[model samples]
Target: MEKYHIKLTEEEAGLLSKIDLRSYHQNHEEGRAAYLNNQEPILALLKSLSGRRAVPEVRLSYWNDPNYRSGRIKGSRKGLFERNGCTGSDIYTHPHFLEQLRYFLFGTELPDAVIEAFEAKVGNPEWVSSSDIVPIGKAARDLTRRYRLDIAAAPEEFFKLCLDMGLGLSAAESVMRSVKQVR
Candidate 1:
């Protein structure tokens, strides 16, 4: 495998730079909303390149549903819905997406054994544990950092990484292209 030094295009760098760690705890609602809205331009750019790839479907049945948010923080609930809905993070990070991305980028899909190895390397006890991969807290920060670096390094590699990470390929490609064009 070729080791490509991924550099973020100016737009990607700008986007990554906008992410503030404080938003994770202080103004989660605002942060989520902002992230959700930002997806629009990125998605548009991806569509231009990949021509309408399948958009990840996010289940929003719990957003306004009182039954779901009863115990959850009131302000955070809606924000969660918007962010998950817009970015399709709920779906993108699923194993299926990871497999698709791996296939697209490396021309080799991750087998079950490989996945097990990866989980071991990451030291995640519950590989698919919802609690372990809480999107509201640490996951968000980690994603922000990872994405920023990926976009900054190699747009193509970052696109491939997104796919491998279960984010839709077209969407990733589009965002990368936008970053490239801006730079």
Candidate 2:
């Protein structure tokens, strides 16, 4: 229910775009590690979350998407389908990463295998077969209705909200300021 606006030039926005996002998500760990590594600002903010609980929920919005209301999730090769609460885009959270949050923030560490075990139990929801994510048009509408989102966010502001979670004043102002410079 919390919202932040992040702005990016066409270039940084490229980093935030579905293209690089797909690239970052393709291999999951290594891909994101590589992606964030290249993106120094995002990496710094990610590290800043050490020992913190209740990190912000990362939900992306396709502001320019118009086909948001059909409620039909499309598979890359196939037309539309629904599995569980998920529609498409195999966005599985890295349990090890989340476990770190629990460990740092709550002082409890879950076994590395827990995430996989949970996935195995719940069944993984694979996205449309192709790596190309055809813009999350279907779910965007639902997301819009459910969450109060800003028109858009400045990349730095988005990262701050990502780190601070709108809980209070973010402590990462310097980091955010540096990010603006990079952009």
Candidate 3:
């Protein structure tokens, strides 16, 4: 895969900083609200992109309705999504949007595996045992230092950057996989 050396402008960085990455990844509604609420920068950034053609309206839709089970809340959001015209292409994953988002957030186009690792490990306590916390954290710190990234101030970003930059699969695997006792 070709590597993109992405750098974020001060304004873009500030805009991304306002978003809570953890909530954006872990909780759908809260994250969507944050993005929707702080969409000026996002729209401006996309507009500035030379390769971008269509600028999507930043709004909420229910493509992945966590409340779609047989209950009162079921299809509640679906109707809203239909009314909002959010049923088309997922704007969040659109190439242009992702390109800008990745640049602002990770400073590079991280692989899908790395992104998955982040969603799996960070803020999910069951993935890593208490004993493994220190080691995993230390590993993340060391990896970030090696990459010369200044995101260590934020541990969440630090870990994601490190894992993507070449922290080896061990850190993610160690945290994500449970040890199976040999019979």
Best by TM-score: 3
Q: Residue 47 in model 3: shift from native, Å?
A: 2.3
How many residue-pair clashes does candidate 2 contain? 9
Q: What residue pairs are clashing in model 3?
A: none
Better of 1 and 2 by lDDT: 1
Residue-level lDDT tens digits of model 2 in 80-170: 2222342322212222233222222222122224223322332323322222111222222223233433323222332332232321122
**Residues 1-183, candidate 3, lDDT per residue (tens digit)?**
223233456765575565434423557676676656545655555444423332211111112333321234456334445445555434543322443354333443434454444444454544544566555555444444445444522343433343444443344334322211101
Who wins the lDDT comparison?
3
| TM-score for all models, in order of appearance | 0.21, 0.17, 0.28
Task: Assess each prediction's global lDDT (C-alpha) against the native.
Answer: 0.36, 0.29, 0.41
Candidate 3 segments whose C-alpha is farther than 4 A from its true place = 1-5, 23-29, 51-100, 103-183
Ten-residue region with minimum lDDT total, candidate 1: 54-63
Better of 1 and 3 by lDDT: 3
TM-score of 1: 0.21
Query: lDDT tens string, model 1, 1-183?
Result: 322112344554454344332224347577566556544444333233234332222112222333322234553344544555634544423222333333322332223343343334335333433343333223323333444433343444333333344443344444345444322
Instruction: At residue 84, give the lDDT of candidate 2.
Output: 38
Q: Sort the predicted structures by lDDT, highest score first.
A: 3, 1, 2
Angstrom error of the Cα, residue 96, model 2: value is: 10
